[model samples]
Every structure is written in C-alpha cells, then in structure tokens.
Target: MPLLAADNLSLERGGRQLFRDLSFKVFPGQLVQIEGANGAGKTSLIRILAGLSRYGYEGRVSRSGAMLYLGHHSAVKALLTPRENLAWHVSGEADFSDRDIEHALARVGLYGYEDVPSHALSAGQHRRVNLARLYLSQSPLWILDEPYTAIDVTGVGELETLFAQHARAGGAVLLTSHQAMAVDYPVSRLDLTAGIAS
Candidate 1:
C-alpha cells in the first residue's frame, strides 16, 4: 500500500494558480523527488502533502503510517543545544535516550557541538542538527523540503546513502531538492511544472 496519496490537489497564491488537479502517491520503498522551478509551488505542494498547510488548498491527503517532515527552515531553537533539540523535538517524537540523540547528532557531523548553543552554530551546522532527526526517526515516511540547502558536498552524499538505505529497508522518502541525487537507488520524480509523476 502507498504510504501517502494526494487527490486532485489545486492551489492558488497571489492571484496566480500554481498548480491544478495535481495528484500522486508515494509508496513504500520509493524515493520520490518533487521537481519544479522557484515559483512553481514545490514547497507549497510539499507542505500540502505533509499536512502542514491543510486549509489553504483543495485536496485530500491520506497517510498510512507515521511520517517525519523536515521543512525548508532549520526549525532549531536558537537557545537550545543540538542534543536538546532532538530530545524535545517539536514533531512530538518519542523520548530517546541521551546516547541515541548524541549518536544521531554525530552521524550528521555535530558530534562535539551537541551541547553547544544553536545560536553559535553556522547555518550548515544548524541544518545538520535538523538532519540528525532523519537518523533517529522511526517513521515509515519522510517528507523533506529543501533538505540540501546548507549541506556540504560530503553531507549531501551521506544523505543520498541514507535515503537509499531507507528505501531498501521498506521506508519511503519524498523530498524537494534542486541538487540532483547521485545515489545507486532509483529515484522517482514528480515534476510540478509538468504536473506529472515519472
């Protein structure tokens, strides 16, 4: 069964129609990328699918299991440390032990900075803190928006490997990224510009 499905989605912003009658399904073990130009409503579409913007559009979104959504913003609190952010995530994830949180931070290259204030970290480091959630998440579906924004080349490669691993493990990932993936796994594309999934 599909992890998530969108039916007849349509959106209009600022008197401009971004998309109309858009629909797609994200199934288990699939890595899907939402593709579009800057003003093509990629983020809008992702937000709709993730159930973050429920009232503004016309569509029905259904999910089969728990999901993890990482939006374009880092969403890290400036006063909190990396460890604290993961320990008390806004997504309401289950309580994880200190060891697991630190390990996840380490995987995303925030090992020693786990206790450092988020205000002192660079943009990329803040992004890493958000990426750490991917490692700790047990959700079957991951919906990420612009996940590669501040990551380094090596970090990007690591994320690709992680995505591939997730798909191989019967999990699904739906993300919006301008950088083309260079992984060994097959990536399905949902081009918002063309209103088609391929």
Candidate 2:
C-alpha cells in the first residue's frame, strides 16, 4: 500500500473553493512535489495530509506510518539554542540523546552554533536548524511546506542530498517548494493547478 493516499479530496477557504476531487498517492522512496500557483491550496492540501485539518474538505486520506511535518514557519523557539531546540523538538516522539542532537546540528552546518540562541542565527541558519529535524526523524513519511525558504545554495544542496538519501532508504517525502529541485531521484509531481496527477 502507498504510505499515504488521498481520494477525492477537496477544500475551501472564505467560501472560496480552493480545490476539488483531487487524488494522489505517495509511496515509499518517492519524492512527491505539490505544485500550484499562489492561493492554489497547496498548503491546505498538505495540512490535510498531515492530519492537521479536515474542514471544508471531502476525502479519504489515509496513512500507514509516522509522519514528520515542517510547515512554512521554522517552528523553533527564538530563545533556545540549536541543541536545546532540537532536543525539545523531537523529545515527544524519539528519545534523542545528546549525541544525536549534536550530530543532526552538525549535519545541518550548525555545529558551533549549538549553544547559541536561534535569534542570533541568520534566517538561513534558522531554517537549517529546523531542518535538522529531518536527520533526527525516523518517520517514514515527511510532509514539508516551503522547506527551502531562506536556504542558501549550499544548504539546498545538503537538503537535496538528504532527500535523496531518505528516498533511497525507502522513506517518502511530500513537499511544496517554488525553488527548483535538483534531486537525482525520480520525482512525481502533482500540480494542483492542473488537477490531481495520475
């Protein structure tokens, strides 16, 4: 079975029909991109898949495993250091040790900034710190929205590598990004403007 499946999905906002009758499946090792113009309900669709919303939607959305979600916001505490933040972020789902937190930070190029408050980091750095959750996460499915925001070219390369590694390891990623992707893995795109993709 696909890691996630959405059948005949629909949603509305402010009485405006954002999308309708959309369907798609995300399988293990697949990188699925959700594409659309502004106000095309891309973020709304992702929220439903993440189980964060069900209003004004009709659909059977199902998933078989754990899912990690990173929305538009970085979702980090400004006062907390990278190490403290990561430890706090994943503490609910996984028992991440200090070594694990440090390792994830290092992978995201935040090694020396581990103890510095997030507010001190640049926007890109803040985004990278949040992305370290990808390394710490063991979820089979990842739902990310605008994850590349504020990321530099080097950071983008690193993230693309991480995405490829995740897919090669039989994990799946569903994401929305305006920036072009340079991943080596085959990508399946669901363009909301064009309706559901087969």
Candidate 3:
C-alpha cells in the first residue's frame, strides 16, 4: 500500500469550497509538494491530511501511525523553554530523554538556546526551536505547511539536509512552500491550480 493516499478529497472553509475531488498518493521515499498560489486551499488540504479536519471533507486517507503534521505558524510556545515546548506537544506515549531533547535542540541549531524562553530568542531561533521536534518525532510521514516561514538560511539548509535523510530512511513528506526549493533528491509536485484548470 502507498504510505498515504487521498482520493476524491474535498475541503471547505468559511462555508466556501476550497478544493474538491482531489486525488493523490505518496509512497516511501517520496516527497510530495503541494504548490499553489496563496489562498488556494493549501492549508485546508494539509489540515485534512493531518486528521484535524475530520468532518470538513469527503474523502479517504490511508496512512499508518507514523504521521507528523506542522502548520504555517510555529507551534512552539513563547513562554516555555524549547525543551519544555516540545515536551508539551510531542507524545507522552513516546519516551525521549533529556539527551534526546538536547540532541534535537543541537541538530536544529538551537544548541545553547535550549533553556531560554522562546520569547527571548530571535525569529530564526524560535523557528529552529519549532523544528527541533522533527528530530525526535520518528514519524514516517511529515506533512508541513509553510515550514520555511521563520528560519534563517542556515536553518533552511539544515532542514533540507534532514529532509533528505528522512526520505533516505523510507519516510515520506508532503509540504507547501512559497519560496522555490531546489531539492537534490527526488520530489514530485502536485499543482492544485493545474488540476482545477484541467
């Protein structure tokens, strides 16, 4: 079976239809990019992919347990330390020790900023803190919407390296971005507007 599949999917927001009858599939080692102009339902589509919009769409999504979803805004809490912020949202079912958290922090370029409240950090540092969770998530499917919003060039390169590593490990990613990316790895893109025009 494909790692994840969406068939005849539809999503609406504010009582307006965002997208309809969309079908797609993602398999192991594949990175699926959803490209569209702003307000073309990218966020809504990801919400359904993440299972956060259960009743807002009519479709079938087949996926296994290892799915992680990140939205446009960094979910990291401003009042908490980076370590504490991750601890709150990541699963209690999974056990990640202090070492794991520390390593994750370091990997995302937040090495010395781990203990500081996120509000004290710069925008890029805050984004790195948000991305640190990916190191420990261990999910096979990563669905990110505008994941590049707040990071610096170094952090973006780090993220691309990490994404390449994940795909090498048979993981899958579905993401949206406004900035053009040159991925050195294999990637397939689904142009939503093209589908609509056709």
Arranged by lDDT with the best first, the candidates are 1, 2, 3
What CA RMSD would candidate 2 show? Answer: 1.3
Q: lDDT for model 1, on a 0 to 1 scale?
A: 0.92
The candidate that achieves the highest TM-score relative to the unseen native structure: 1
**Any idea what lDDT model 2 has?**
0.89
Decreasing TM-score order of the candidates:
1, 2, 3
Q: Candidate 1: lDDT of 84?
A: 90
Q: TM-score per candidate, in order? A: 0.96, 0.95, 0.90
lDDT by residue for model 3 over 1-198, one digit each (tens)? 577888899777788777888988888898878888888888878888888864557888878767888888888788999889877767553888888888989998778877998889887777777788788877889999888887877777878878888989999888988776667897788877675421
Q: State the lDDT at 138 in candidate 2.
A: 91
lDDT of each: 0.92, 0.89, 0.81
Q: Higher-lDDT candidate among 1 and 2? A: 1
**TM-score of predicted structure 2:** 0.95
